[model samples]
Target chain A: MRSKTRRAALAVLSAGTLLLAAACGGDDSSEADESTITWWHNSNNEPGKGYYEQVAKDFEADHPGVDVQVSAMAHEDMVDKLAAAFQSGDLPDVYMERGGGELADHVEAGLVRDLSDDAADEVEKIGGSVAGWQVDDKTYALPFSLGVVGFWYNKEQFEQAGITELPITMDDLYDVIDKLKAADLTPLSVGAGDKWPAAHYWYAAALRSCPEEVLTDAVGSLDFSDDCFERAGDVVEELIETEPFNAGFLSTPAQEGATSASGLLATGKVAMEMQGHWEPGVMQGLTDDGKGLGDKTGWFPFPEVDGGEGDPAAQLGGGDAWAVPEGSPDVAVDLVRYLLSDEVQTGFAENDMGLPTNPAATGAVSDPALAQLLEVRDAAPFVQLYFDTAFGESVGGAMNDEIALMFAGKASPDDVVSATQQAADEEK
Target chain B: MTRGGWRQRLEILLFVTPALALLGVFVVWPIASAVRMSFYRWKGFGPMEDFVGLRNYDRVLGDDVFRDAVAHNVVIVVASIVVQLPLGLAIAMLLNRKIRLRGLLRTIVFVPYVMAEVIAGVIWFQLLQPRYGVVDGIISAVGLTPPEQGFLGTPELALPTLFVVLTWKYLGLAVLLFLAGLQGVPDELYEAAQLDGAGWWQTQVRVALPLLGPTIRTWLFLSMIGSLQQFDMVWVLTGGGPANATTTMATYLINQGTQRHNYGIAGAASVVLFLVSFVMALAYQLLILRRDTVTQE
Candidate 1:
C-alpha cells in the first residue's frame, strides 16, 4: 500500500509537470523559405477579407517564384498572436503595424526595417499620415488606412431624446446626455470592461484640453507633468458622475454581440458610442438583419472643450500600416508599395473598409457619413494616435488601468495623473 | 542479488533514459531556465543582458494587483475545501444507495466536468449578463431585482460569483471520485458497525469517512493545485477585470509575458507560483499523508 501511494504521488507530480511543459513548449515552427511573404491582417470579415485575398493572388501572379501567404484574423487575436510570434522570433515577413511606441520598441530591437529610402514614392503619396509611423523623420511603415474617432450615434434615438442638433462643446454634450436620460434612454454606451474603450474617453478629453505641442512633447520626454492631462481626467470624471452610460457599462464588452456597447447603439438601445470608422461594420455584424443602423447612423467629431487651448479640429485616431521585418527580402517592400497603389486604395475606399491614406482615392469614399469624417480629417491641424498604441504596451497599459479605475469610480483624476507619471518613470 | 547484476542495471538504465531526457528537456530545464530568467530584466525577445537581481520579485510582491490576485487564488482554495468537497461528498453518499435512474443521474451530474473550461466560462458569462441574461430574466419573472452592476461585473461579488461557477463546473469530478472511493469501502464494515449498535449517521461518520481518507487527501491536493493554477475560466469570464477582481497568478503571468512583454517579471511570478505549489505538496505529504504510509507499512 505504501509503494502504491508512492507511485500515485509520483504519477501526479509527473502529470502536473507535463501540463506545464505543454503550456511552455507549444510554439509553432515557421517555414524558412525566403521567397514566401507571410502577411497578417485584422480584416477577417467579408469584402475586406476577400479583397485582401485578391490582392495577394494578384501580387503572386505578377511576380513569378513569389508566394503571398495571407492570414486574416480578428484584431485582438492578431495582437496576441503577433506578440507571441515576436517573442519566439517567428515573426512574419510583412504584417500590419500600428505605429507609435510599439513601432519604436520594434525599431529599437532592430526587428523593423527602415522603409524611407526603399518606399519613398509610397511614403510621399500617404502624406502626413505617415508621421505616426516615423521616428525622427525616418519611416518604418506605410499607413494604408487613416480615420478619426467620433460619435457613431443612432439619429432616431437623438430625435426621440428631443436633441435637434449635434453638440459643438463639452457643456452642450452634457446637455444632450441629460436630455437622453430624461427620455429614459441610455445616453452613452461605453465598454469600460475592455479598458481601451473607456481609455478613449480620457484620450478625447486630453485632445480637447491640451495643445498639440504639449501632447507631442509628452511622448518624446515621457513627462506627463502638464495640467491638461489631469484636466482631461477631470472631464471624464464629471461625465462619469452624470451616470450617462448604460446600466452595466463597466462590465459590458466593446463589440462582442447584441449586448455589447456597439451592439447597444446598433440595436437602438443606446443613443451613441464613441468609436472609430470601423464602427459601422462592427455594428452590422452585431445586428440580426445585417443592415445595422444603416441611414439612421450619423457621425460627429468629438465635442470641443470650451475655453481649452487645443484646436477643435485636432482629432484622435489610428490606422493600420504595413511594415517589413528585418532581413526581409526586397519583395516585401514591393508588396507594401503595391498595397498603397492608387488602384488598391481606390478599391479599399469603395468597399467602405476605411479612409484610405492615398490622396488620389479621397473621392472614392461612397458612404456619406465617412465622407463627412474625411472632411473633418482633412481640416484637422494634427491627429493623435490612440494613446495606448502611441505609448506602447507598458505605459499605455498602466494608463489604461488607472483610467479604468476612474471609470469604476475607484480612482480620482489626481490619482490617474500620479499613477500614469509613476508608470512612465518605472517603464523608463 | 541477481536483480542488482550488471545486465539488469544496464537494462533499467536503458529503459529510463528516454523518460529522463524528456523530463529534463520539458520540465527540469524549463524550471531552471525560468529561475535564471527571474534575475534579469529581459523582454521575451532580444538579449538577456540586464540583470536586475530579484528586482522583478520585489516589484511583483509590492504590486497591489498581484497581491489581490494571490488573495483571489487563496479564496478559491478555501472555497473548494470548505464548500465544494463537502457538497460533492454528500451527493456521492446519496447516490451510492439503491435508486432509480442512478446511472442517468450520475451521468447528468458528471457532464459539466467534461466540458471545456473556456466554453463553460463563455456560457456562464452570457447566462449571468446583467439585464438580458436568463438569470436576470428568471429573477425578474419571480419578482426580484438583480444587482445593478450584475454579478461578474461588480468587484465585491465577482470573485464569489466565479466561485459558484467553479463549484458548478468542478463539483462533478469530486462526486465521481468519492463515488469510486465509496465502492471500495467493504459492506462488512457497515455490518460490523451496525452490530455494535451504530446508527446510520454513526456508520457514515465512524466507518465510511475514515476508510475514504486516501481519496479525500488526493482530492484535496488536486483541488488546491488546480485553484492555484486556474487560468482559462477566469480569463474568458472576466479577463481579470471590472478591476483586476478575478486575476489569478497564472493570468497575471500571461498578462505580463504575452501582453506587456515583461518576461522577467512573468518568470519571477512563475517561480513564485511553482515554489508555493511545491511547498504545499511537500507539507501535505510530510504532515498529513505520512501517517497513511506509516500505518499501511
Candidate 2:
C-alpha cells in the first residue's frame, strides 16, 4: 500500500514537472520571428487601444512580410513588465518610454537605440518637446504627447463660493480656499495616498522658488543645497496648514473609481484637483452620465509664489515618447516615425488622449480648456519634467516619502530637504 | 542488501527525487542567489560588477522606514496571537456545540477563508471608506462622527484597522482547524468529566483544552509565519502609506526592489526577512515542538 502511494506521488510529480517545462518553453518559439516588430504601449483603453491596433495593421499592410505585434497594458503593469524584460534581455522592439531618469538609465546601459540621425525628421516635427526625450542634445526617442500639470476646477463651484477671479498668487489661492470652505465646499481634493499627487505640490513650489539654472544644475549635481529647496518645502507646509483638501484626502486614491480625487471634482463634491492634462477623460469615466464636469471644468496654472526668484512662465510637465531598443531592426525606427506622422498625431489629439507634441496636431484638440492649456504650455519659458520622473526612482521615492510625511504632519520643511539630500547622497 | 530491500529503497528514492529537485531549483536556488546578490550594488539590470559588501545590509538596517516596517510586522505577529487566535478558538468552541444551524454557522465562518486576499482587502477598503462606505454610514446613522482621515488613512488607526481586516480574513481558517481538533477529542473523556461532577467550563479546561494542544500549536505556527509574510492585503489597502504607517517588512522589500530599483538593498532585506523567519521556525521546533517529540517518544 505504501509503495502504491509512492507510485501515485511520483506520477503526480512528473506531471507537474512536464507542466512547468511546457510553460517555460512556449515563449521561446514565439520570440524567434525576426520580421515581427513588437510594440508595448500603455494605451490599454478603448479608443487608444483600437487606434494603435489599426495603426499596426496599416503598417503591416504597407510593408509586406512584416508583422507588427502590439501589446497594450495598464501603465504601471507596462513599467513592471518592461523592467522584467530588461532584466531578461527580451525587450520589445518598440516600446513606450517616459523620458527622464528612467530613460537615462536605459541609455547608459545601451539598451535603447539612438534615433538622432534615423528619425530626425519626426523629431523635427515634434519641435521643442522632443528635447524631453534627448540626452546631452542627442535624441533617443520621439515625443508623442505632452502637457502641464494644473488645477482642474469646477466653474459652478467657483461661482457658488463667490470667487470671481482666477488665483494668480499664493495668497489669492489661499483666499479662494477660505471662500470655498465658507461656502461649505471642499476647496481641493488631493490624493496623498498615491504619493505622486502630493509630491506635485512640492515640485511646483520648488519650480516657483528656485531659478531655472538651479533646477537644471541640481539634476546633474544632485545638490539640493540651495535654501530655495527648503523654501519649497515651507510653501507646501504652509499649504498643508490651510487644510484645504477634502476630508480623508490623505487616504483617497488619485483616479481609480467614483470616490477618487478626480471623481470628487467631476461629481462637484470638491472644487479643484491638481492633475495632469488627462484629468478630463478620467473624470468623465467616473461620472454616472459620462459627461463629467463638461463645460463647468476650467484649468489654471499653479499659482506663483510671492517674491520668488523663478519665472512664473516656467512650467512643470511630462509626456510619453516612443523608443526603439538596441539590437532592434531598422524597421523599429520606421515604426516610431510612422507613429509620429502628422495623421496619427492629429488622430491622437482628436481622441482627447493628451496634447500632441507634433506642431501640426495642435489645432486638432477639441476641448477649449485643453486648447487654453496648450497656449499656456507654449508660452512657458521653461518646462521642467515632473520631479519624480526626472529624478529617477531612488532619489524621487525618498523625496516623495519625506514630502508625504510632511503632508501627514509628521515631518518639518527642513526635514524634507535633509531627507532628499541624504537620499541623493546615497545614490551618488 | 537483499533484492527486495534494494528494490523498496529505489522506489522510495524515485518518489522523492522529483520533489527534491523541484524544490532545489525553485526555492533553494533563488534564496542562494538572493543571498549572493545582497553583497552587490546592482540595479537589477546590466552586469553585477559593483561589489559593495555589507553596505546594503548597513543601509537597510539604518533606514527609518525599514525600522518602522519591522515594528509593524511585530505588531501584526503579537495581534495574531493575542486577538485572532483566541477569538477563533472561542467561535470554534461555540460551533462545536450541538446547536441548531451549526453547520450553516460553520460554513458562514469559513467563507472569508476561501475569499482571495486581494479581493478581501479591496472589499474591506470599500466598506470602510470615510464618507460613502458602509461603516461610516452606519456610524453617521447612529449619531456619531467617523474619523475624519478615515481608518486606513489615519496613521494611528491604519495599522490597527489592517490588523482587524487581517483577523477577519484569517480567523475562519483558525476556527476550522480548531473545530477539526474538537471533533477528534474522545466523547468518553467528556462523559468521564461529567461523571466526576465537572461542569462545562471545568470539562473544557481539564480535558478538551489539554487534548487540543497539538492542533493549537500547529495553528500557532502557521499564524506566526503568515503574519511575518503578510503582504497582499497591506499592499492593496494602504500601499504602506498615509506616510508608511502600514508598511510591513515584505512591503518594504518590494518597494525597494520593484519601485526604487535598488535590488541589492532589497536582496539584503530579503536575507534579513528570511533569517528572521528561519530562526523563528528553528527555535519553535527546538523549544516547543521538541517537547512534543520527547513526550511522544
Candidate 3:
C-alpha cells in the first residue's frame, strides 16, 4: 500500500510540473485574432470616459465584424499595467505613450509600430507636435494633446498680495515674491516629494538659460557640460534662496489630495504653483464643490532669466500619444489615425480633456484658462519636452533626486549637474 | 533487498518529494535567477545580454545613496531592539499582574500588531503631517513649537520619527511574546519566592527574568530581522525623502529596479541584501539560538 501511495504521488508531482510549464510557456499573442483590436486608455472619468466609449462604437460601426475591446483604467493603473505588458511582450493593440526617451526606448526594442508611412496624411495634419514621438525621423506614435507647463496662480491671492502686472523677468518675479511675502502669503508651493515637480523648476530654468540649439543637442548627446546648464541650476538656486515656497514643501506630494501642491493653489492657500495644462482638471478633482479656483484661476508663462541665451518665448512641455504595438493588426493604425482626426480631437477639446494637438480643434477649447494656454503653446518658438522625460527614467530619476536634494538645502547647483551627468554617462 | 524495507523507503520518499519539488520551484529558482540577473546590465524588459560581471555590484556599493540606505537599515535594527526591549518588557510584566481589567489592558497592548502595516502607516502619515496634523496641532496647543517642515519632512528627524512609529506598530508583538513566556513560569516557583519574602520587583528580576532568557533572545532575533527588512512604513511615511534621509536597503533596491529601471543594479543590491541577511541569520542561529535548541535536545 505504501508503495502504491508513493507511485501515485510521483504521478501527481510530474503532472503538476507539466502544468506549471504549460502555464509559463503559453504565448499571449500566438492565438490573437485579426478581427479583434484591444485599446487601453486612461480617460476613466466622466465626459472623457463616455466620449471615448462613443468614439470606439463609431469606429466599430464603420468597420463591421471588427471587434475593438476598450479598457479604460485610472492613469496610474494603466501605466503600471502597460509596464508589465511591455516586460511580458504581450501588449494591447494600441495604448498611450508619453513620448521622449521612453518612446525612443520602445522603438529601439521593436515594440512600437512606425506610423510614418501608414498614417502619413494624419501625420502631416498633426505637424510639429508629433516630433516628440518620432525616433530618427520615423514617427512611432501620434500625439493627441500637446501642452506646456507654466505657473498656475490664484488671481484673488495675486490681487491680495498687491501684484499689479504679471512678472516678465527674473527680477520682476523676485519683486512679486517679496510683495507676496510682505502680504504674509506663501508665494509658491512645489511638490518636491514627487521629485518631478521640483525638477520642473530646473527644466524651465534650462529652457530659459540655454540656446535652442544647445538644448536640442544636449538631448541627443546626454551631455550637460554647457555653461547654460550650470546657469539654469544657478537660477534655481537664487529662487530657492528667496525662501518663497510653502512651509513643509519639501515633502509635499504633487496632485494626490487637498494637502498637495496643486491642492494648496486650488484651495487658495498659496498664490502660485508651477504645473502642466492639466492643473485645472486636477484642481477640480481635489476640491469638494468640483469648481477648483473657480473665477480665481489664472495662468502665466515662466519668466525669462537675465542674460539668458534661449528665446524668451520658449516653453517646457510634453504630451501623451496613441501608439500601436508592433504586432497589432492594420486596423489598429486606422483607429489611431481616426482618434487623431479633427472631428474626434474637436470633441476631445469640447470635453476639456486636454490641450488638443489638431489645429482644427484648437478653437474649440471652452475653458478660458486652457484657451490662453493653447495660445501660448502655439506662439512659443518651440516647446522643449520636460528634460526628465527626454532623458528617460534612469537618468531623469537621478536628476530629479538631486534637484529634490537641492530643494532641501542639501545639494548645491554644481552637485545637480554632476549627478545628472554621471547617470547619463552610465546610459552610454 | 527485503520487500518490506523497499516499501518503507518508498513511503518516506512519497512524503518528501512534494515538499522538495515546491522548494526547488519557488525558493531556489527565484534566488538563482536573481543571482544570474546581477551579472547583466539589461533593462527590466529586454534580453539579458549585456553581461557586466561584478560591475553592477561595484556600482551598488559605490553609490552614496545605497551606502546611506545600508546605514539606515543598521540603525533601525539596533534601535528596534534597544527601544522596544525594555518598553515591551515593562508593559508585559505589568499586565501579568492580578490587576483590574487585565484582559482589557492586554487586548489594548496587542491591538496595533493585529492592524495591517499599510493602514497603520497611512494613519501615522496623516497624524504627523506638518502644520495641520494632529501631533503638530497638539504641540501648538500645548504652546510648544513643532518642526518647521513637519516631523517626516525634516532631514534630521525623518528617521527618528519613523523609529517612533515603528515602535508603536511592533511593540505589541514583543509584549505578546513576553507575556506568553511569563505565563509558562510555574506557580510553585512564585509561591516559593513569596514565602521567602521576595518583593514583586525582586521576584520578577531574580526569578522570572532568568527563566525568560530564551524568549527574550528569540524576540530580539525576530525584531532585528523585521527592522532590517523594513519598507512599507518608510515608503508611505516619507518615501525616503527630505534628502533620502530614511532609506533602507529594501527601498533602495525597489527605487533602482522599478522607478529608475536599473534592473542590474537592483539585482546586485538584492544579492548583497540576501548575503547580509543570510550571514546575520546564520550567525544568530549558531551563536544565539543554538543554546535554546541544545538545551531542548
Query: Could you report the DockQ of all the candidates, in the order they appear?
Result: 0.30, 0.53, 0.67
Model 2: residues >4 Å from true position, as ranges? A1-34
- Candidate 1 — which residues are off by over 4 angstroms? A1-36, A60-65, A74-77, B1-4
Best by DockQ: 3
TM-score of chain A of each: 0.91, 0.94, 0.96
Q: What is the TM-score of chain B alone in each candidate?
A: 0.96, 0.97, 0.97
In candidate 1, what are the lDDT values of residues B65-139, reduced to their tens digit? 889999999999999999988899899988998899999989989999999998898999899988888998999
Q: Per-residue alpha-carbon lDDT of model 3 for A156-224, expressed as tens digits?
A: 988998899999999999999999999989999999988899999999999999999998888889999
After aligning candidate 1 to the native by TM-score, how far in Å is the CA of B290 from where it should be? 2.1
Ranking by lDDT: 3, 2, 1
lDDT of 3 at A198: 97
Off by over 4 Å in 3: A1-26, B1-5
Which of candidates 1 and 3 is the stronger one according to lDDT? Answer: 3
Q: Residue A319 error for model 3, in Å?
A: 1.0
Better of 1 and 2 by TM-score: 2
